[model samples]
Target: MFSADALIQTSGNIVGGTAGAFLGGYFAIKVMRTQIEFQRKQNQQEKEEQYEKTYWLMKLVFEGLGSSIDDFQKTMNKPDIDDKKDYPYLIGLLKGTLSVSKEKKELINDNYIPKDIYREYLAGITLFNSCEFIIERWYQTLHLDNFKISTDNYQFKDLIVYGNGMRHIFNEIESIKPIKKKVTTTGGGAK
Candidate 1:
Protein backbone atom coordinates (compact mmCIF):
# COMPACT_ATOMS: atom_id res chain seq x y z
CA MET A 1 0.00 0.00 0.00
CA PHE A 2 1.30 3.48 -0.80
CA SER A 3 1.94 6.00 1.93
CA ALA A 4 -0.41 9.03 2.12
CA ASP A 5 2.41 11.43 1.17
CA ALA A 6 3.26 9.31 -1.91
CA LEU A 7 -0.36 9.36 -3.05
CA ILE A 8 -0.50 13.15 -2.68
CA GLN A 9 2.71 13.56 -4.68
CA THR A 10 1.37 11.33 -7.48
CA SER A 11 -1.87 13.33 -7.67
CA GLY A 12 0.03 16.61 -7.83
CA ASN A 13 2.23 15.32 -10.68
CA ILE A 14 -0.78 14.21 -12.73
CA VAL A 15 -2.49 17.60 -12.27
CA GLY A 16 0.65 19.44 -13.35
CA GLY A 17 0.99 17.28 -16.45
CA THR A 18 -2.60 17.98 -17.53
CA ALA A 19 -2.17 21.74 -17.06
CA GLY A 20 1.05 21.75 -19.09
CA ALA A 21 -0.55 19.84 -21.92
CA PHE A 22 -3.46 22.25 -22.07
CA LEU A 23 -1.21 25.32 -22.14
CA GLY A 24 1.01 23.83 -24.86
CA GLY A 25 -1.95 23.01 -27.08
CA TYR A 26 -3.47 26.44 -26.53
CA PHE A 27 -0.24 28.24 -27.46
CA ALA A 28 0.22 26.10 -30.55
CA ILE A 29 -3.23 26.99 -31.82
CA LYS A 30 -2.74 30.67 -31.09
CA VAL A 31 0.57 30.74 -32.98
CA MET A 32 -0.95 28.98 -35.98
CA ARG A 33 -3.83 31.43 -36.10
CA THR A 34 -1.45 34.37 -35.94
CA GLN A 35 0.64 32.97 -38.81
CA ILE A 36 -2.44 32.50 -40.96
CA GLU A 37 -3.62 36.05 -40.33
CA PHE A 38 -0.19 37.42 -41.21
CA GLN A 39 -0.14 35.54 -44.49
CA ARG A 40 -3.58 36.82 -45.43
CA LYS A 41 -2.60 40.40 -44.82
CA GLN A 42 0.62 39.97 -46.83
CA ASN A 43 -1.31 38.57 -49.77
CA GLN A 44 -3.75 41.46 -49.70
CA GLN A 45 -0.95 44.01 -49.65
CA GLU A 46 0.74 42.37 -52.63
CA LYS A 47 -2.46 42.44 -54.63
CA GLU A 48 -2.99 46.14 -53.91
CA GLU A 49 0.57 46.94 -54.97
CA GLN A 50 0.18 45.04 -58.20
CA TYR A 51 -3.01 46.92 -58.99
CA GLU A 52 -1.39 50.29 -58.33
CA LYS A 53 1.54 49.48 -60.61
CA THR A 54 -0.72 48.38 -63.42
CA TYR A 55 -2.88 51.46 -63.10
CA TRP A 56 0.09 53.81 -63.22
CA LEU A 57 1.48 52.06 -66.26
CA MET A 58 -1.77 52.48 -68.13
CA LYS A 59 -2.00 56.10 -67.00
CA LEU A 60 1.47 56.78 -68.39
CA VAL A 61 0.50 55.34 -71.74
CA PHE A 62 -2.61 57.50 -71.89
CA GLU A 63 -0.69 60.65 -71.04
CA GLY A 64 1.93 59.91 -73.65
CA LEU A 65 -0.66 59.46 -76.36
CA GLY A 66 -2.45 62.65 -75.30
CA SER A 67 0.79 64.61 -75.55
CA SER A 68 1.56 63.19 -78.96
CA ILE A 69 -1.83 64.21 -80.21
CA ASP A 70 -1.28 67.72 -78.89
CA ASP A 71 2.05 67.94 -80.65
CA PHE A 72 0.51 66.79 -83.90
CA GLN A 73 -2.16 69.47 -83.61
CA LYS A 74 0.44 72.16 -83.00
CA THR A 75 2.39 71.01 -86.02
CA MET A 76 -0.72 71.25 -88.14
CA ASN A 77 -1.44 74.81 -87.00
CA LYS A 78 1.87 76.27 -88.21
CA PRO A 79 1.37 79.62 -90.03
CA ASP A 80 3.17 78.39 -93.16
CA ILE A 81 -0.10 77.23 -94.84
CA ASP A 82 1.62 77.08 -98.25
CA ASP A 83 3.81 74.22 -96.97
CA LYS A 84 0.73 71.96 -96.77
CA LYS A 85 2.26 69.80 -99.51
CA ASP A 86 4.68 68.25 -96.98
CA TYR A 87 3.18 64.77 -97.01
CA PRO A 88 6.48 62.99 -96.41
CA TYR A 89 7.32 65.20 -93.44
CA LEU A 90 3.89 64.68 -91.87
CA ILE A 91 4.13 60.92 -92.46
CA GLY A 92 7.49 60.85 -90.74
CA LEU A 93 6.07 62.69 -87.76
CA LEU A 94 3.09 60.38 -87.53
CA LYS A 95 5.31 57.30 -87.77
CA GLY A 96 7.58 58.60 -85.05
CA THR A 97 4.63 59.19 -82.73
CA LEU A 98 3.25 55.71 -83.41
CA SER A 99 6.65 54.15 -82.79
CA VAL A 100 7.00 55.87 -79.45
CA SER A 101 3.51 54.84 -78.39
CA LYS A 102 4.17 51.23 -79.42
CA GLU A 103 7.42 51.16 -77.49
CA LYS A 104 5.67 52.49 -74.37
CA LYS A 105 2.95 49.88 -74.72
CA GLU A 106 5.55 47.13 -74.99
CA LEU A 107 7.35 48.44 -71.94
CA ILE A 108 4.17 48.38 -69.86
CA ASN A 109 3.37 44.88 -71.07
CA ASP A 110 6.83 43.66 -70.19
CA ASN A 111 7.20 45.27 -66.78
CA TYR A 112 4.80 45.25 -63.79
CA ILE A 113 2.30 43.15 -65.72
CA PRO A 114 1.24 39.57 -64.96
CA LYS A 115 -0.40 37.09 -67.29
CA ASP A 116 -3.62 37.51 -65.35
CA ILE A 117 -3.63 41.25 -66.15
CA TYR A 118 -3.74 40.66 -69.90
CA ARG A 119 -7.43 41.42 -69.90
CA GLU A 120 -6.79 44.77 -68.31
CA TYR A 121 -4.26 45.49 -71.06
CA LEU A 122 -6.83 44.59 -73.68
CA ALA A 123 -9.26 46.96 -72.03
CA GLY A 124 -6.65 49.67 -72.16
CA ILE A 125 -6.35 49.09 -75.89
CA THR A 126 -10.08 49.41 -76.21
CA LEU A 127 -9.95 52.68 -74.32
CA PHE A 128 -7.29 53.91 -76.71
CA ASN A 129 -9.45 52.97 -79.66
CA SER A 130 -12.38 54.87 -78.17
CA CYS A 131 -10.20 57.95 -77.74
CA GLU A 132 -9.08 57.69 -81.34
CA PHE A 133 -12.63 57.26 -82.50
CA ILE A 134 -13.85 60.33 -80.68
CA ILE A 135 -10.99 62.36 -82.07
CA GLU A 136 -11.85 61.18 -85.56
CA ARG A 137 -15.46 62.18 -85.05
CA TRP A 138 -14.50 65.64 -83.92
CA TYR A 139 -12.21 65.93 -86.92
CA GLN A 140 -15.00 64.90 -89.23
CA THR A 141 -17.24 67.59 -87.79
CA LEU A 142 -14.59 70.24 -88.38
CA HIS A 143 -13.86 68.97 -91.92
CA LEU A 144 -10.31 68.22 -90.80
CA ASP A 145 -10.78 64.45 -90.70
CA ASN A 146 -8.16 64.01 -93.36
CA PHE A 147 -4.95 62.29 -92.33
CA LYS A 148 -3.03 65.37 -93.38
CA ILE A 149 -4.03 68.03 -90.81
CA SER A 150 -4.90 67.86 -87.11
CA THR A 151 -7.47 70.12 -85.44
CA ASP A 152 -7.50 71.71 -81.98
CA ASN A 153 -10.90 70.33 -80.98
CA TYR A 154 -9.92 66.86 -82.05
CA GLN A 155 -6.76 66.97 -79.97
CA PHE A 156 -8.65 68.25 -76.93
CA LYS A 157 -11.24 65.54 -77.39
CA ASP A 158 -8.52 62.94 -77.51
CA LEU A 159 -7.09 64.17 -74.22
CA ILE A 160 -10.51 64.21 -72.60
CA VAL A 161 -11.24 60.69 -73.75
CA TYR A 162 -7.96 59.41 -72.41
CA GLY A 163 -8.52 61.14 -69.08
CA ASN A 164 -12.00 59.68 -68.75
CA GLY A 165 -10.79 56.16 -69.42
CA MET A 166 -8.01 56.51 -66.88
CA ARG A 167 -10.49 57.71 -64.30
CA HIS A 168 -12.77 54.77 -65.01
CA ILE A 169 -9.98 52.26 -64.58
CA PHE A 170 -8.90 53.84 -61.32
CA ASN A 171 -12.43 53.85 -60.00
CA GLU A 172 -12.84 50.21 -60.92
CA ILE A 173 -9.66 49.16 -59.15
CA GLU A 174 -10.42 51.20 -56.05
CA SER A 175 -13.97 49.93 -55.74
CA ILE A 176 -15.22 53.42 -55.06
CA LYS A 177 -18.48 52.62 -56.75
CA PRO A 178 -21.26 51.41 -54.46
CA ILE A 179 -22.36 47.79 -54.71
CA LYS A 180 -25.92 47.26 -55.86
CA LYS A 181 -28.01 45.17 -53.49
CA LYS A 182 -30.63 42.92 -55.04
CA VAL A 183 -34.13 43.48 -53.70
CA THR A 184 -36.30 40.43 -53.30
CA THR A 185 -39.97 41.08 -54.10
CA THR A 186 -42.41 38.89 -52.19
CA GLY A 187 -45.91 38.89 -53.75
CA GLY A 188 -45.40 42.47 -55.04
CA GLY A 189 -45.38 43.78 -51.50
CA ALA A 190 -42.88 46.52 -50.65
CA LYS A 191 -40.75 45.52 -47.71
Candidate 2:
Protein backbone atom coordinates (compact mmCIF):
# COMPACT_ATOMS: atom_id res chain seq x y z
CA MET A 1 0.00 0.00 0.00
CA PHE A 2 1.26 3.54 -0.83
CA SER A 3 1.91 6.01 1.93
CA ALA A 4 -0.80 8.73 2.40
CA ASP A 5 1.66 11.59 2.08
CA ALA A 6 3.22 10.09 -1.10
CA LEU A 7 -0.23 9.65 -2.72
CA ILE A 8 -1.19 13.28 -1.98
CA GLN A 9 2.14 14.51 -3.44
CA THR A 10 1.55 12.41 -6.59
CA SER A 11 -1.98 13.81 -7.00
CA GLY A 12 -0.72 17.33 -6.60
CA ASN A 13 1.94 16.72 -9.32
CA ILE A 14 -0.66 15.32 -11.78
CA VAL A 15 -2.96 18.31 -11.29
CA GLY A 16 -0.08 20.76 -11.62
CA GLY A 17 1.14 19.08 -14.85
CA THR A 18 -2.31 19.11 -16.47
CA ALA A 19 -2.89 22.78 -15.59
CA GLY A 20 0.54 23.72 -16.93
CA ALA A 21 -0.19 21.94 -20.20
CA PHE A 22 -3.53 23.72 -20.64
CA LEU A 23 -2.06 27.14 -19.90
CA GLY A 24 0.84 26.60 -22.34
CA GLY A 25 -1.53 25.52 -25.13
CA TYR A 26 -3.74 28.53 -24.51
CA PHE A 27 -0.84 30.93 -24.76
CA ALA A 28 0.44 29.27 -27.94
CA ILE A 29 -2.92 29.75 -29.65
CA LYS A 30 -3.09 33.38 -28.58
CA VAL A 31 0.35 34.06 -30.00
CA MET A 32 -0.56 32.40 -33.29
CA ARG A 33 -3.76 34.42 -33.59
CA THR A 34 -1.92 37.64 -32.87
CA GLN A 35 0.72 36.90 -35.50
CA ILE A 36 -1.96 36.03 -38.07
CA GLU A 37 -3.83 39.28 -37.42
CA PHE A 38 -0.65 41.28 -37.76
CA GLN A 39 0.16 39.59 -41.08
CA ARG A 40 -3.32 40.25 -42.44
CA LYS A 41 -3.09 43.93 -41.58
CA GLN A 42 0.35 44.14 -43.21
CA ASN A 43 -0.95 42.56 -46.41
CA GLN A 44 -3.90 44.94 -46.58
CA GLN A 45 -1.60 47.94 -46.15
CA GLU A 46 0.62 46.73 -48.98
CA LYS A 47 -2.38 46.32 -51.31
CA GLU A 48 -3.53 49.87 -50.54
CA GLU A 49 -0.09 51.22 -51.33
CA GLN A 50 -0.02 49.42 -54.66
CA TYR A 51 -3.47 50.74 -55.53
CA GLU A 52 -2.35 54.31 -54.88
CA LYS A 53 0.72 53.85 -57.07
CA THR A 54 -1.36 52.46 -59.93
CA TYR A 55 -3.93 55.26 -59.63
CA TRP A 56 -1.25 57.94 -59.77
CA LEU A 57 0.41 56.32 -62.74
CA MET A 58 -2.84 56.13 -64.68
CA LYS A 59 -3.65 59.75 -63.88
CA LEU A 60 -0.27 60.92 -65.10
CA VAL A 61 -0.67 59.05 -68.38
CA PHE A 62 -4.22 60.29 -68.84
CA GLU A 63 -3.35 63.98 -68.34
CA GLY A 64 -0.26 63.82 -70.52
CA LEU A 65 -2.14 62.17 -73.38
CA GLY A 66 -5.03 64.62 -73.03
CA SER A 67 -2.71 67.60 -73.37
CA SER A 68 -0.92 66.07 -76.35
CA ILE A 69 -4.20 65.31 -78.10
CA ASP A 70 -5.42 68.87 -77.59
CA ASP A 71 -2.21 70.28 -79.01
CA PHE A 72 -2.37 67.98 -82.03
CA GLN A 73 -5.97 68.98 -82.79
CA LYS A 74 -5.24 72.70 -82.45
CA THR A 75 -2.26 72.50 -84.79
CA MET A 76 -4.24 70.52 -87.38
CA ASN A 77 -7.11 73.07 -87.33
CA LYS A 78 -4.96 75.98 -88.47
CA PRO A 79 -6.40 77.01 -91.88
CA ASP A 80 -4.44 80.21 -92.46
CA ILE A 81 -1.03 78.57 -92.82
CA ASP A 82 0.02 77.84 -96.43
CA ASP A 83 0.73 74.12 -96.69
CA LYS A 84 3.30 74.46 -99.43
CA LYS A 85 5.19 77.39 -97.91
CA ASP A 86 4.98 76.20 -94.27
CA TYR A 87 4.99 72.49 -94.88
CA PRO A 88 7.98 71.92 -92.60
CA TYR A 89 6.55 74.11 -89.89
CA LEU A 90 3.18 72.40 -90.18
CA ILE A 91 4.91 69.03 -90.05
CA GLY A 92 6.64 70.03 -86.83
CA LEU A 93 3.35 71.13 -85.37
CA LEU A 94 1.66 67.88 -86.37
CA LYS A 95 4.32 65.72 -84.71
CA GLY A 96 2.60 63.43 -82.24
CA THR A 97 5.04 63.58 -79.36
CA LEU A 98 3.15 61.74 -76.64
CA SER A 99 6.19 61.23 -74.50
CA VAL A 100 5.87 58.64 -71.71
CA SER A 101 8.41 57.78 -69.07
CA LYS A 102 10.10 54.38 -68.92
CA GLU A 103 8.57 53.60 -65.52
CA LYS A 104 5.08 54.42 -66.76
CA LYS A 105 5.58 52.33 -69.89
CA GLU A 106 6.77 49.43 -67.79
CA LEU A 107 3.47 49.39 -65.92
CA ILE A 108 1.80 48.15 -69.10
CA ASN A 109 4.82 46.35 -70.50
CA ASP A 110 5.42 44.37 -67.32
CA ASN A 111 1.75 43.54 -66.80
CA TYR A 112 1.36 45.78 -63.78
CA ILE A 113 -1.77 47.38 -65.24
CA PRO A 114 -4.89 45.32 -64.68
CA LYS A 115 -5.94 42.91 -67.44
CA ASP A 116 -9.04 44.95 -68.35
CA ILE A 117 -7.08 48.16 -68.89
CA TYR A 118 -4.11 46.43 -70.52
CA ARG A 119 -5.62 46.14 -73.99
CA GLU A 120 -6.85 49.74 -74.05
CA TYR A 121 -3.46 51.08 -72.97
CA LEU A 122 -1.67 49.10 -75.67
CA ALA A 123 -4.21 50.21 -78.30
CA GLY A 124 -3.72 53.84 -77.28
CA ILE A 125 0.02 53.53 -77.73
CA THR A 126 -0.36 51.87 -81.12
CA LEU A 127 -2.74 54.56 -82.38
CA PHE A 128 -0.45 57.32 -81.16
CA ASN A 129 2.56 55.77 -82.87
CA SER A 130 0.55 55.18 -86.05
CA CYS A 131 -0.39 58.84 -86.14
CA GLU A 132 3.26 59.75 -85.83
CA PHE A 133 4.11 57.49 -88.76
CA ILE A 134 1.34 58.98 -90.90
CA ILE A 135 2.61 62.50 -90.21
CA GLU A 136 6.14 61.47 -91.15
CA ARG A 137 4.97 59.89 -94.42
CA TRP A 138 3.00 63.00 -95.30
CA TYR A 139 6.00 65.22 -94.55
CA GLN A 140 8.20 63.09 -96.86
CA THR A 141 5.87 63.92 -99.77
CA LEU A 142 7.57 67.33 -99.93
CA HIS A 143 10.30 65.70 -102.08
CA LEU A 144 7.70 65.03 -104.77
CA ASP A 145 7.01 68.25 -106.72
CA ASN A 146 3.42 67.38 -107.66
CA PHE A 147 2.48 66.14 -104.18
CA LYS A 148 1.04 69.07 -102.19
CA ILE A 149 -0.36 68.67 -98.69
CA SER A 150 -3.97 69.83 -98.73
CA THR A 151 -6.77 69.37 -96.24
CA ASP A 152 -7.23 65.93 -97.75
CA ASN A 153 -4.22 63.61 -97.92
CA TYR A 154 -3.98 59.86 -98.35
CA GLN A 155 -3.00 59.66 -94.65
CA PHE A 156 -6.29 61.27 -93.67
CA LYS A 157 -8.10 57.95 -93.81
CA ASP A 158 -5.60 56.34 -91.42
CA LEU A 159 -5.53 59.44 -89.25
CA ILE A 160 -9.29 59.30 -88.93
CA VAL A 161 -9.06 55.70 -87.81
CA TYR A 162 -6.39 56.61 -85.26
CA GLY A 163 -8.46 59.50 -84.00
CA ASN A 164 -11.47 57.28 -83.38
CA GLY A 165 -9.35 54.64 -81.73
CA MET A 166 -7.76 57.25 -79.46
CA ARG A 167 -11.16 58.58 -78.48
CA HIS A 168 -12.18 55.10 -77.36
CA ILE A 169 -9.00 54.65 -75.35
CA PHE A 170 -9.46 58.03 -73.72
CA ASN A 171 -12.97 57.03 -72.70
CA GLU A 172 -11.67 53.82 -71.18
CA ILE A 173 -9.04 55.70 -69.22
CA GLU A 174 -11.59 58.19 -68.03
CA SER A 175 -13.85 55.43 -66.84
CA ILE A 176 -11.12 53.94 -64.66
CA LYS A 177 -9.98 57.24 -63.22
CA PRO A 178 -10.24 57.24 -59.43
CA ILE A 179 -12.79 59.56 -57.88
CA LYS A 180 -11.30 62.17 -55.60
CA LYS A 181 -12.58 62.03 -52.07
CA LYS A 182 -14.06 65.29 -50.86
CA VAL A 183 -13.67 66.47 -47.30
CA THR A 184 -16.51 68.10 -45.38
CA THR A 185 -15.99 70.52 -42.53
CA THR A 186 -18.33 72.05 -39.96
CA GLY A 187 -18.49 75.79 -39.40
CA GLY A 188 -15.25 77.27 -38.08
CA GLY A 189 -14.44 80.66 -36.67
CA ALA A 190 -11.02 82.15 -35.95
CA LYS A 191 -12.35 85.13 -34.04
Candidate 3:
Protein backbone atom coordinates (compact mmCIF):
# COMPACT_ATOMS: atom_id res chain seq x y z
CA MET A 1 0.00 0.00 0.00
CA PHE A 2 1.25 3.54 -0.70
CA SER A 3 1.78 6.12 2.04
CA ALA A 4 -0.28 9.39 2.01
CA ASP A 5 2.88 11.49 1.21
CA ALA A 6 3.80 9.26 -1.78
CA LEU A 7 0.23 9.50 -3.17
CA ILE A 8 0.27 13.29 -2.81
CA GLN A 9 3.65 13.52 -4.59
CA THR A 10 2.38 11.35 -7.47
CA SER A 11 -0.70 13.59 -7.88
CA GLY A 12 1.53 16.67 -7.91
CA ASN A 13 3.72 15.19 -10.67
CA ILE A 14 0.65 14.37 -12.82
CA VAL A 15 -0.73 17.94 -12.46
CA GLY A 16 2.66 19.45 -13.37
CA GLY A 17 2.91 17.23 -16.46
CA THR A 18 -0.62 18.24 -17.62
CA ALA A 19 0.15 21.95 -17.23
CA GLY A 20 3.40 21.61 -19.17
CA ALA A 21 1.66 19.82 -22.01
CA PHE A 22 -1.02 22.55 -22.21
CA LEU A 23 1.55 25.33 -22.26
CA GLY A 24 3.61 23.65 -24.93
CA GLY A 25 0.61 23.14 -27.19
CA TYR A 26 -0.51 26.75 -26.71
CA PHE A 27 2.92 28.18 -27.59
CA ALA A 28 3.22 25.98 -30.67
CA ILE A 29 -0.11 27.25 -32.01
CA LYS A 30 0.86 30.85 -31.30
CA VAL A 31 4.12 30.50 -33.23
CA MET A 32 2.35 28.91 -36.17
CA ARG A 33 -0.19 31.73 -36.30
CA THR A 34 2.56 34.35 -36.30
CA GLN A 35 4.38 32.60 -39.17
CA ILE A 36 1.20 32.45 -41.23
CA GLU A 37 0.52 36.16 -40.72
CA PHE A 38 4.02 37.04 -41.76
CA GLN A 39 3.74 34.99 -44.93
CA ARG A 40 0.41 36.63 -45.81
CA LYS A 41 1.83 40.12 -45.38
CA GLN A 42 4.82 39.26 -47.55
CA ASN A 43 2.58 37.92 -50.32
CA GLN A 44 0.44 41.07 -50.26
CA GLN A 45 3.49 43.29 -50.55
CA GLU A 46 4.78 41.33 -53.53
CA LYS A 47 1.45 41.61 -55.32
CA GLU A 48 1.28 45.38 -54.74
CA GLU A 49 4.77 45.83 -56.18
CA GLN A 50 3.93 43.76 -59.23
CA TYR A 51 0.83 45.87 -59.86
CA GLU A 52 2.79 49.12 -59.58
CA LYS A 53 5.37 47.90 -62.07
CA THR A 54 2.69 46.83 -64.54
CA TYR A 55 0.83 50.15 -64.22
CA TRP A 56 3.91 52.25 -64.91
CA LEU A 57 4.81 50.11 -67.89
CA MET A 58 1.31 50.56 -69.34
CA LYS A 59 1.47 54.32 -68.77
CA LEU A 60 4.75 54.63 -70.67
CA VAL A 61 3.42 52.70 -73.63
CA PHE A 62 0.24 54.80 -73.73
CA GLU A 63 2.22 58.02 -73.64
CA GLY A 64 4.49 56.92 -76.47
CA LEU A 65 1.62 55.68 -78.64
CA GLY A 66 -0.52 58.73 -77.95
CA SER A 67 2.28 61.09 -78.96
CA SER A 68 2.92 59.18 -82.17
CA ILE A 69 -0.79 59.09 -83.10
CA ASP A 70 -1.19 62.83 -82.46
CA ASP A 71 1.79 63.61 -84.66
CA PHE A 72 0.51 61.38 -87.44
CA GLN A 73 -2.98 62.87 -87.31
CA LYS A 74 -1.63 66.39 -87.47
CA THR A 75 0.45 65.51 -90.49
CA MET A 76 -2.52 63.90 -92.20
CA ASN A 77 -4.77 66.91 -91.60
CA LYS A 78 -2.36 69.24 -93.40
CA PRO A 79 -3.67 71.07 -96.50
CA ASP A 80 -1.23 69.15 -98.70
CA ILE A 81 -3.40 66.01 -98.71
CA ASP A 82 -4.04 66.38 -102.44
CA ASP A 83 -0.30 66.50 -103.22
CA LYS A 84 0.81 63.04 -104.28
CA LYS A 85 4.40 64.07 -103.70
CA ASP A 86 3.69 64.46 -99.95
CA TYR A 87 2.95 60.73 -99.64
CA PRO A 88 6.61 59.92 -99.11
CA TYR A 89 6.80 62.48 -96.32
CA LEU A 90 3.84 60.82 -94.56
CA ILE A 91 5.48 57.41 -94.90
CA GLY A 92 8.71 58.77 -93.48
CA LEU A 93 6.87 60.20 -90.48
CA LEU A 94 5.24 56.81 -89.77
CA LYS A 95 8.56 54.97 -90.07
CA GLY A 96 10.22 57.39 -87.69
CA THR A 97 7.42 57.06 -85.14
CA LEU A 98 7.41 53.28 -85.25
CA SER A 99 11.16 52.89 -85.10
CA VAL A 100 12.39 51.31 -81.86
CA SER A 101 15.57 52.06 -79.87
CA LYS A 102 18.76 50.24 -80.87
CA GLU A 103 18.43 47.90 -77.88
CA LYS A 104 14.75 47.26 -78.61
CA LYS A 105 15.50 46.77 -82.30
CA GLU A 106 18.03 44.10 -81.48
CA LEU A 107 15.61 42.41 -79.09
CA ILE A 108 12.90 42.46 -81.75
CA ASN A 109 15.24 40.91 -84.28
CA ASP A 110 15.93 38.23 -81.66
CA ASN A 111 12.11 37.94 -81.18
CA TYR A 112 11.15 39.90 -78.02
CA ILE A 113 10.75 43.31 -76.35
CA PRO A 114 13.54 43.65 -73.76
CA LYS A 115 11.41 46.15 -71.80
CA ASP A 116 8.05 45.86 -70.02
CA ILE A 117 6.59 48.91 -71.80
CA TYR A 118 6.59 47.18 -75.16
CA ARG A 119 5.15 44.04 -73.59
CA GLU A 120 2.28 45.98 -72.00
CA TYR A 121 1.62 47.78 -75.26
CA LEU A 122 1.49 44.48 -77.10
CA ALA A 123 -0.90 43.03 -74.53
CA GLY A 124 -3.04 46.17 -74.43
CA ILE A 125 -3.41 46.20 -78.20
CA THR A 126 -4.70 42.65 -78.06
CA LEU A 127 -7.17 43.36 -75.21
CA PHE A 128 -8.47 46.40 -77.10
CA ASN A 129 -9.84 44.36 -79.97
CA SER A 130 -11.15 47.29 -82.01
CA CYS A 131 -7.57 48.42 -82.69
CA GLU A 132 -6.17 44.87 -82.95
CA PHE A 133 -5.69 44.68 -86.71
CA ILE A 134 -3.59 47.84 -86.94
CA ILE A 135 -1.69 47.08 -83.77
CA GLU A 136 -1.15 43.47 -84.83
CA ARG A 137 0.55 44.60 -88.02
CA TRP A 138 2.76 46.95 -86.04
CA TYR A 139 3.61 44.18 -83.57
CA GLN A 140 4.46 41.79 -86.37
CA THR A 141 6.84 44.35 -87.87
CA LEU A 142 8.70 44.38 -84.55
CA HIS A 143 8.82 40.56 -84.59
CA LEU A 144 7.56 40.51 -80.99
CA ASP A 145 5.92 37.09 -80.74
CA ASN A 146 5.84 36.42 -76.98
CA PHE A 147 3.14 38.88 -75.99
CA LYS A 148 1.14 37.31 -73.16
CA ILE A 149 -1.52 38.96 -70.99
CA SER A 150 -0.79 38.67 -67.28
CA THR A 151 -3.75 37.62 -65.21
CA ASP A 152 -1.78 38.45 -62.07
CA ASN A 153 -2.88 42.05 -62.62
CA TYR A 154 -6.59 41.41 -62.92
CA GLN A 155 -7.62 44.90 -61.87
CA PHE A 156 -5.42 46.52 -64.51
CA LYS A 157 -6.78 44.17 -67.12
CA ASP A 158 -10.36 45.05 -66.13
CA LEU A 159 -9.60 48.76 -66.24
CA ILE A 160 -8.11 48.50 -69.72
CA VAL A 161 -11.05 46.50 -71.02
CA TYR A 162 -13.64 48.80 -69.45
CA GLY A 163 -11.97 51.99 -70.65
CA ASN A 164 -11.49 50.69 -74.18
CA GLY A 165 -15.08 49.45 -74.38
CA MET A 166 -16.42 52.80 -73.19
CA ARG A 167 -14.27 54.67 -75.70
CA HIS A 168 -15.43 52.43 -78.55
CA ILE A 169 -19.12 52.90 -77.66
CA PHE A 170 -18.62 56.64 -77.35
CA ASN A 171 -16.95 56.74 -80.75
CA GLU A 172 -19.81 54.84 -82.38
CA ILE A 173 -22.36 57.22 -80.88
CA GLU A 174 -20.38 60.24 -81.97
CA SER A 175 -20.03 58.81 -85.48
CA ILE A 176 -23.83 58.39 -85.76
CA LYS A 177 -24.39 61.93 -84.54
CA PRO A 178 -22.19 63.27 -87.33
CA ILE A 179 -24.06 61.23 -89.94
CA LYS A 180 -27.39 62.53 -88.60
CA LYS A 181 -26.09 66.08 -88.71
CA LYS A 182 -25.01 65.64 -92.33
CA VAL A 183 -28.41 64.23 -93.34
CA THR A 184 -30.25 67.05 -91.63
CA THR A 185 -28.03 69.63 -93.32
CA THR A 186 -28.59 68.08 -96.77
CA GLY A 187 -32.38 67.88 -96.22
CA GLY A 188 -32.55 71.53 -95.19
CA GLY A 189 -30.44 72.51 -98.20
CA ALA A 190 -32.86 70.61 -100.52
CA LYS A 191 -35.85 72.35 -98.91
TM-score for all models, in order of appearance = 0.54, 0.61, 0.50
Query: Model 1: number of clashes?
Result: 0
lDDT agreement of model 1 with the native = 0.59
Mind giving the per-residue lDDT tens digits that candidate 1 earns over 43-143?
86775566565556665666556555556556656777433365345445544554565566665533545555455566667776665565444444433
Ranking by TM-score: 2, 1, 3
Model 3, range 1-191, lDDT digits (tens) per residue? Answer: 99999999999999999999999999999999999999999986665455444443333333444444455455545665633444445444544534532122223221222242344444444433333333334344433344322233453244335335433433443333221221233334445
True-structure RMSD for candidate 1: 11.8
Better of 1 and 2 by lDDT: 2
The candidate maximizing lDDT is: 2
Which segments of model 2 are wrong by more than 4 Å?
84-96, 101-103, 107-111, 114-191
Global Cα RMSD, each model: 11.8, 4.7, 18.8
Q: How many backbone clashes does candidate 3 have?
A: 0
Clashing residue pairs for model 1: none
In model 3, which residue pairs have backbone atoms overlapping below 3 Å? none
- The worst-scoring run of ten residues by lDDT in candidate 3 lies at 101-110
**Total backbone collisions, model 2:** 0
lDDT of 2 by residue, 1-191 (tens): 99999999999999999999999999999999999999999986665466557656655554454455455556656877665677666555555343352246447332445555667777777776686677677666765767555446557656756766676676786587443454788998898
